[model samples]
Target: MINLALLIFLVVLFTQIVSWVGKTVLQEVAFAVYSRVFLSGTASKQRQLRKQVLAEKAELGWTSSQDEFAKWAKLRRKLDKGIADLEKINTTLTSSKTSFSVKFNSLLWILMTGSQLFLVWWYRKQPIFWLPQGWVPKPVAWILSFPSAPLGSVSSGAWGAVCKRVLQSVEEIVKAILEPTVVPNGPFPTAPFPAQSQSQPSAKIEPITLEHEKLD
Candidate 1:
């Protein structure tokens, strides 16, 4: 029997991979990855050629302004060549992109996610961890024990859920650490001149003289 630690590790690792890479991207690349691995002979050669064309096109970057007609003409020719080669390869690989995509993606989901679900179900009745009795309230204990697990024990389903959540949090922290901080735009220049202020009439000040001085 595998130790609880090993089960936790597997669940965490798979969850992190699926969560980080994203399911959509994995599905998109499934057919591309599969053909190279499982096909042979001419199919393998076509895959290799397609890969080479893609790498070369990526290196060429996007088409820019045609400042020099000669250079622009050459670039355009190379771009067209790459596109033609890709189309040829795609046509050779499968009759329909939509049909092939659905087939490979479904296979990937069945193999990856299906296995995870099976593992959790197979171990549903078993407890991953045996906690001390009376440590938690009856309701809390029941939740931890859930399904068929004995009270005061942590069920496989609950523990796997916790482990996956913790791993996802760590993945987020790692991404945040690797992300570069954006420097704010430089200080913008203010108005060239101050605005003119409205002026009000100035009141004349009268100085008061002492009574003795006035009398004198």
Candidate 2:
């Protein structure tokens, strides 16, 4: 039989990665080739527009003579018109991409989350692993066991939760390590210390008076 613990970990890890992919890698499946006919040639239309723009640029560059101002101006106008068309395509692509992502990613998330839930239900009575005897209190062990699993056994529910938490922790640590830190433009300023001086007292004239009295 396949190891339940390994399966649970892999599934949880995969779901998390899928969630990240839709968010970070590509916002819309339609714009990327990773999607197979999902967008129904909408992406192809965008490609065609891009090719048209390139063709316009090349044709104008090679054939259109600059010797005649009128001809050059006419070609320039055509190029500008093609560019405007390209911009329209871009605007449409952006809005449609956002629309597609909202629907696709929402559905994707539901499916992925549901798969985990299904696994829990299907193996509700099964244990991913067995905990050492007396390792944890009865209440805690029961919670980990979950559903109908026997005591001192870790059920799918607990294992899935642990896997998710571990993945989140790892992701957080990675982001912390890879994220750029803002440093000050210069070193911190230090305050100067106050100056202190000690003065010595001068010798008194009592010695002169004693010597004078002795001499007198």
Candidate 3:
């Protein structure tokens, strides 16, 4: 009975660790990878777009910390539209990159979860001949087990929702940390300029005289 409880406690602890890292580290790593692959060849444009959004937020006396959810939504819409345009231009590259990232991240999490389970299984066997019996104290295990119950209950997809909520708080802290002491003078540059489409602009040429004439 005691061994059973200890084993369960250890499993819960390891699961919580995996969930925490998934929320914090893996989320950011995924974002960085996605941005690098999707935004390739458009680093300058992306920077300009981000600056433009920041400038708008500043003009409106808003940051991610502010109560203006509408402002954030507007910014997101603009950014999404820009991303859509880029994706259209590089459809194959974007699709391949996204597929690879999803598979890679899934494999990483599987390996991490598998190793944690293996460690707990190994510890349960008590391979050592003689040592201090208990590693995880009973009282400490009980305390950890309390939260671990709810954590274990949460579904896999639920973590993404939880992470999004957690990131809201984190985003505010990041905004405060990044707040500039010295503000820039001018407004940020606008969205990446639109590319020329099907229609072509008409051109005019000036006639030249026998001696010399200017061309327009």
- Provide backbone clash counts, one per model: 0, 0, 0
Assess the local accuracy of residue 149 in candidate 2 as a C-alpha lDDT between 0 and 100.
82
For residues 1-216, write the lDDT of model 2, one tens digit per residue. 778788888889988887666564655434475334465466677687788778878877876475677876777788898788778877876786777777767866665787788889999998888999999999999999998788899999999999999999999999999999998898788887654433455556664444444564
TM-score result, candidate 1: 0.56
- Superior by lDDT: candidate 2 or candidate 3: 2
Query: Where does the lowest 10-residue lDDT sum fall in candidate 2?
Result: 28-37
Q: Give one digit per residue, the lDDT tens place, for model 1 in 1-216.
A: 879657666856875787678877876677567656664554866777677777766645654445566765676677788678767767766764567777766766665677567766777788878888789889999988777788888887778777778887887899899999997799987867643443555667999887654564
RMSD of each: 10.7, 6.5, 31.6
65-105: candidate 3 lDDT, tens digit per residue = 35777877776677667666555545655565577667766
Instruction: State TM-scores per candidate.
Output: 0.56, 0.59, 0.28
The per-residue C-alpha lDDT of model 3 at residue 71 equals: 77
Reference-based lDDT, each prediction: 0.72, 0.79, 0.53
Model 2 / residue 155 / CA error / Å: 1.0
Q: After superposing candidate 2, which stretches have Cα over 4 Å from the reference?
A: 22-24, 27-31, 34-103, 180-182, 195-216
Model 1 ranges with Cα > 4 A deviation: 23-34, 37-40, 43-92, 95-104, 188-216
